[model samples]
Target: MFEQLGLIGCGLMGGSFALAMKKAGLVKRVVGYSKSPSTTDRARQLGVIDVEAPSALLAVAGADIVLVAVPVAATEATLKAIRHLVTPNMLIMDVGSTKADVVQAARRALRDQVGSFVPAHPITGREVSGVEHADAELYTGRQVILTPMDRTLPEQFAKAETVWNALGCRVSNMSPESHDAAFAAVSHLPHLLAFAMMNSITGQAEGDDFLSLAGPGFRDFTRIAASDPKVWRDILLSNREELLAQSRLFQQTLQNIEQAMQKGDTQALEDMITLASETRAHWRMGAQRTSKGR
Candidate 1:
């Protein structure tokens, strides 16, 4: 359990974290700060944070633990802003989607505080945003990745693991680069595709009919595209290289399907469809098994 907990960016993820920690009695106090005054006010009234600080630097000054639950693009600036307030004894971790940049920022700006900084990301979320949607179980049984290198101390990693485990997470260790590349493919690219698909069909001739006939499958496919514009735009820009690599793969696959269609190759089209169906099934089953097999 931690005596003092500080959080930056009190949005859905950050608020949810505070709720979960407090519910588990793992955090005595959660002091939160955000760029938006309205968000801080909401967090306080909703009991997601105990105290609202005027600034992030003041918010985390004496905290035993800190969680930066912001978009990936904001990680460096946020770390630099609060580096002076961090102590080597504290545990500083982030819930940013990308890790390489965050780890580098902490290493450079808060070199002495690196050991206390555990670069982390939880592979979980909802389409909705804001403190109002903060759920107590957002991270329950979710994969929380901790990407540490040889420069990291074992004791620091252990302490980080303790905090995440107490929050009801299944922790996994990985490198920052690997984490970014993997998520860029599995998470980022999908979001990009969904947005593109939605944009393409918005003004099409069948748009009206599509809207009226939209079913569960279509709705599900475009759900992630409905995420916060600012957040998704930042994520897309921040993780560009890895995401572009994944996008290239997607483009090639689409080209293959287009070529098959041009030739009226029903067998090849069938093969692609079958492969996609099987792949999706595997992942769906794997996710269910992970959540329930325990």
Candidate 2:
């Protein structure tokens, strides 16, 4: 077990990780820091942290495990703030959704200590955020992707894997670039689309009326649209390049369906619908099989 865990951010992700570690008996104490004093205080009051540090550097002073759970854009500044306190034995990781930007930030800020940094993205969260909503079971049965740099030490990586495994997380390894690209399509792009769809209707004159008439399909589709704007803004910007590529592909697909509708091609529309139905059915079957196996 880790003697101490220095958590930077102390929000939903960081708070949840600290709680999970404590619940699993993997960490003895947690020292947390955030840009806002109230957030740090709240974290400590909620038992998510044992101490509230005045700064990132102070939080990580004697802790060997540091979790940089700040926004994607704030990662560089957070890393720089504590780089001087980092040690060779320290195991540093982040909960940022995008990896390429985080890796770049680590390389620039951590310098020689970069080898101890293992960039990670936990594929689990809720529509709500903040320390108040943090849960110890957030990482249980969830997938966490670790993107280790070439300079990363094997033992450090193993320690990261061990901690995540102890928390009941299914861990997988991938390159930073691959992780960014894959998540852009599956995670980032979907959030963007949900936000866009909600805006499209809300910007209309009868938006309220339309929403009042919305059914379960609309409710389910727009659920993620209620996510924190600031968090998503950083995520979209960090993975902008990959998201833009995915956007273009989505637009092309939309145009193809639009053309089919405009031409009144009933057979073409039927074929498109049939293809999507089959693909979704197959996907559902595969997901069920995987879940059952797990």
Candidate 3:
């Protein structure tokens, strides 16, 4: 519930957020800006925003809330662009994939006003991007994590939760460091593995043939590989340290499976597969239960 919503980066994530907030009747007006003039124009035409500001600074002017949905690498620049316009009463939040880098960016750019900045990661998106693909239901039944800093104000934090919750998101809180570490293992590593797997297949001589014969399993696993490369590039690099550790762990697991097969250890291979299958099934059922409860 705010008089104005300042939206930076009028792309898929930002556009979807604006639409969701509008659907929830949470904001009176929305002012949007994007680096690409055409994108801002498109957002205005699509009714994702009420007005397209000429610049980032102008977008946040007089707004009670600001949502930064730029790439993780550009967080600092976005923050710097709007820092002068921020006030203590305004609630600032980011929809970044990584938290540590964004937290650092907020501290560097927001300075004394950093207490109003909240770093958030919504665990939901499609392989496709852009405002054209934005949907008001995008965040429905999704998990949104808030990694608030020690300096973050209680009022701002509560407002951030209220906004996301109004949009039908399940909100959870954690430290920025813990957020990065956990997501690196579950989210980042999976995307990287999918990308690597697709590349490995395509680099082979029978790549096209293999793809032509690919079934549901291959299709499902590599679906995320079809996501916007530029977005994934920023995410991968932003959490490279934790991703590297996860990568090493995956490599070791792969080697263990390979060794088992080479040694004709059927039981070992079966055990590994069984563990994965059972764990996935259990997790899936738990998630279904949670969704039903909601």
Candidate 4:
């Protein structure tokens, strides 16, 4: 068990993590800090943290494990804030959606102490965000991607894996570049499409009327459009390169379908639809197998 967990951000992700650690008996104490004083105070009152820290450095003062749960844009500044107190044995991790930029931030901010930092991306969250919405079961049975740098300490890496595993997470390792690229296609690009789909509909004069007629399909497809704007904004920008590449590929496929429609080619349209339906069915089968621990 860790002696103390120094939590930065104190919002949904950080607060949930602290609660999970406490539930699993993985950490003895949690000291939390946030950009907003009220947030830190609320986290303490909610029992998400045992102590309130005034600054990031103070939060890390005596903690053996630290979680930097800030936005992708604030990662660099947050790491620099606590770098002075970072120790070789301390295991630091982040929950940012994108990994490449986060790894770069750690390298620049921590320098020789970078070995203590292990970049992590936990694939789970709710549409609502804040300390009040934090759930102890947030990471349970979810996938967590860890991207450790070459300089990362083996002992610290092992501890990081143990902590997440204790919380009931399925932990996997990947390079920062590969992690970012893969997520850009699976996660980031979908958020981008959701945002655009919402805008495209709402921009019309009959938008409200059209929304009234939306069925379960539309609701299911557009659920992610209601995600926190600022958080998604930072994520989309941080992994823009890979996201854009995926977007171009999506456009190519869309154009092919559109051309088939223009030519009134029923056979081509049916073929494309069949291909997509079969692909989605195959993916669902594989996903079910993985969920059963195959």
RMSD of each: 2.8, 2.8, 2.6, 2.4
Model-by-model lDDT, in order? Answer: 0.85, 0.90, 0.90, 0.91
What are the per-model numbers of colliding residue pairs?
0, 0, 0, 0
lDDT of 2 at 283: 78
lDDT-wise, the better of 1 and 2 is 2
**How well is each residue in 1-294 modelled by candidate 4, as lDDT tens digits?**
899999999988999999999999999999999999999999999999999999999999999999999898899999999999999989999999999999999999999999999898989977788999999999998888889999999888889888988999877888889888998988898899999999999999999999999999998888888887878899999999999999999999999999999999999999999999998777841144232210
Ranking by TM-score: 3, 4, 2, 1
In model 4, the runs with Cα more than 4 Å from the true position are 285-294
| Alpha carbon lDDT at 52, candidate 4 | 98
Supply candidate 1's per-residue lDDT for 252: 98
Estimate the TM-score for candidate 4.
0.95
Candidate 4: Cα lDDT at 17: 100
For model 2 the TM-score comes to 0.95
**RMSD value for candidate 3:** 2.6
Error of 2 at 53 (Å): 0.6
Tell me the tens digit of each residue's lDDT in model 3 across 160-260: 88898899888888888888998899889999999988999999999999999999998898888988787889999999999999999999999999999
Relative to the unseen true structure, what is the Cα RMSD of model 4?
2.4
Evaluated with TM-score, which candidate comes out highest?
A: 3
lDDT of 2 by residue, 1-294 (tens): 799999999888999999999999998999999999999999999999999999999999999899999889999999999999998899999999999999999999999999989898988878888999999999898888888888887878889989988999877888889888988888899899999999999999999999999999988888888887878999999999999999999899889999999999999999998998898777741143121111
Q: Candidate 4's C-alpha lDDT?
A: 0.91
